[model samples]
Target: MKYPKIRELKEAIVSLLTPAYTSKFPAEPHVPFEKFRGKPSVDDENCVGCETCANVCPSHAITFTDDKEKGIRTIIRDYGKCIFCGQCEEHCITKKGVILSDKIYDMAVFDRSKSIEYQEKELLICQSCNAIITTREHLHFMHRKLGPKAFSSILNLNILNQKLRLAEGQDVSVEIKDGLKRKDMFNIICPNCLRVILVKYLSKGV
Candidate 1:
């Protein structure tokens, strides 16, 4: 049989003497590289409980629960189901609310509950229907972004007129208008109630 090449024999000997490439995890820490997409984390101080993260999560790792009686909304994030895709960070309206860190990979736990995180915020109830509309923080943020015009659409004509007058430092009595109207303004009314109101207005042909 032909003898192995001298280079091959030398390489084999060197490999045997060299240290193993496998990491000694748990015994020694491992530092991930830059831009590594590891476990997701959130800044509760910056989070407004908008549910945007839950909506964008592809793996269903994020879920939201609303307590209508208590007017509370809870957002839960299960790390056990997270794929570390960073979609939550990408869609977070408040950039500091959610982010993917490079160093939080050691998320092993004996109990599934240990791997879950949650945050809760108070919800805003509709004034007329008493339905859970959204978080108070979300409403405030939208109002700040959209200005006083925010409530002009959903509020009835009387309410809208009063709101406008109050905002403009004027006083006026509420006068109800019995006609359909459309104006480009924002409102806190939930989609369902808005739909019903819209249908009623349209049927009146005004």
Candidate 2:
């Protein structure tokens, strides 16, 4: 290494004088450029726990679990597996549910669990078949989107009645114990069971 070529010497000098292309992240604060895709931030007020993010996530970073007994739906977001593809932000039904943040991008972590997040919403379980219905928040979101048309469905009407407490202390679950009867219409029955009730009983004017 006694003698260096003229081109090599010139290249060395140029590199030494030029500003670094890589930023000193830990040593200095760095602001990302405009339209930079970074961490995905959630707006809980607008998020209805619809599982739409989980469905569209290519990396499977988002997951959902429902506990029927507790009437709760848990949403899990593992940032360690996230590719920051912006699919969650793009397909969000509410449009304001999830969005990728441009400012906060530092996600370095030693433990994987530290990068995980959990959120819970009330589940709207079917009282008849015990089937897993959508979350209460999701139904409310649909009600807002559908407006007056939402009342066309008996399930939505029952949910609205429960929220408004039209009957006050009257128990809607009283007749659900016997079977899928006409009275089950007053309770939180699923669309399938509601269809059965209408076809079998209501059609004959029971």
Candidate 3:
């Protein structure tokens, strides 16, 4: 067999004399090195469930399911499928929604389900056609980002109705009259329904 070069032999000797070059994970708690990108830690309070992470995840570790009937958006984050590329954290719209927890590097688990997590956000379904507008939190995030300009769109005002109960006693039920009327424009409506209303009004020229 060919012998190791002088430099290689010297390196082997030095490595042998040195303590373990790796962390004693099982025996001792793992101490991740600086700038270590580990498992993603979600902040529910900050996560708007906008599907940004799910869209950017290269490995499809994050996924979302919308239930229009229930008006809920479910987000599933499977750490078992995560490559820990830190894309979720890097592209988070809220900037603090998903963060890489350097301390949570060890994700070894027998049950894959144990490594999966779920989050739910209230979805804003269009009252006219039952179409999904977006998550309420995502709309709120948009409002914060757009500031005063967001009020230009009646859709943005949906949040006020939720908090102020502006139409609590009004008979603005979305029973889908012959066609969507102007009265339903203020309600949480999809762009398609709103377009119909706008066109109907502009056509009348009254």
Candidate 4:
């Protein structure tokens, strides 16, 4: 028993002399390990303001506000409510739009507002109802992703081309094509109006 106690004491002394395995956080910069999910970052240039990140955020940390009168869409991300989940990064249409960064976790702030990040983009209005439909960049992104045939069934290519032209500040006119013209309106239609028109058109077998 005495020898066992002496051996235990010697082991404790050796441990005390050995280097610490625990990290000295705060005193020294703490580097996060590989695949560590930390803060989320958004690249506005690639984001297109799709609202996918806001919709997929499990913590409800991301929010979107649309100002129709001002033709602006505002996206807000609150790091204080973020759970460091990678959902936003995974579901982003453009992979480069959102990403989980390995940045240090020093998010302490005196004012809670300081932990919030905001981004704004211009909105595209419906040419018919004048309602805010989506962002200009988002329409362009969809056009690039889906190509000209994407909206062929629901919308005419000529109309879509006119919409793109209108987005570029070009003057264009809406002409009746294939006997399908809605008050000579072209460019874009609100979802509600589109649904109603599609239902009526389908019922007519045209």
Candidate 3 Cα errors over 4 Å, as ranges: 1-17, 171-175
The lDDT of each candidate is: 0.73, 0.89, 0.86, 0.76
lDDT of 3 by residue, 43-142 (tens): 9999999999999999999999999767789999999999989999999999999999998888878888999999999998877788787898999899
Clashes of each: 1, 0, 0, 0
Instruction: Mark the regions of model 4 whose C-alpha exceeds 4 Å error after superposition.
Output: 1-12, 151-183, 194-206
Clashing pairs in 3: none
- Where is model 2 more than 4 Å wrong at Cα? 1-4, 172-175
Q: Candidate 4 local accuracy as lDDT? A: 0.76
lDDT of 2 by residue, 92-126 (tens): 99999999999878887789899999999999888
Local distance difference test, candidate 1: 0.73
lDDT value, residue 47 of candidate 3: 96
- For candidate 3, what's the RMSD? 2.9
Q: Clash pairs of candidate 4? A: none
TM-score of every candidate relative to the true structure: 0.69, 0.94, 0.88, 0.74
lDDT per residue as tens, model 4, 1-206: 99999999999999999999887876876778887888888888999998998998999999999997778999999999999889999999989998988885677679999999999998866655666778878877877888866676343443466654644663432322454345433445656666666666656866
Q: Provide the global lDDT of candidate 2 against the true structure.
A: 0.89
Order the candidate numbers by lDDT, best to worst: 2, 3, 4, 1
All-Cα superposition RMSD per candidate: 6.9, 1.9, 2.9, 5.1
Candidate 1, run of 10 with poorest lDDT: 171-180
| Minimal lDDT window, size 10, model 2 | 170-179
Please give the lDDT score at residue 2 for candidate 4. 100
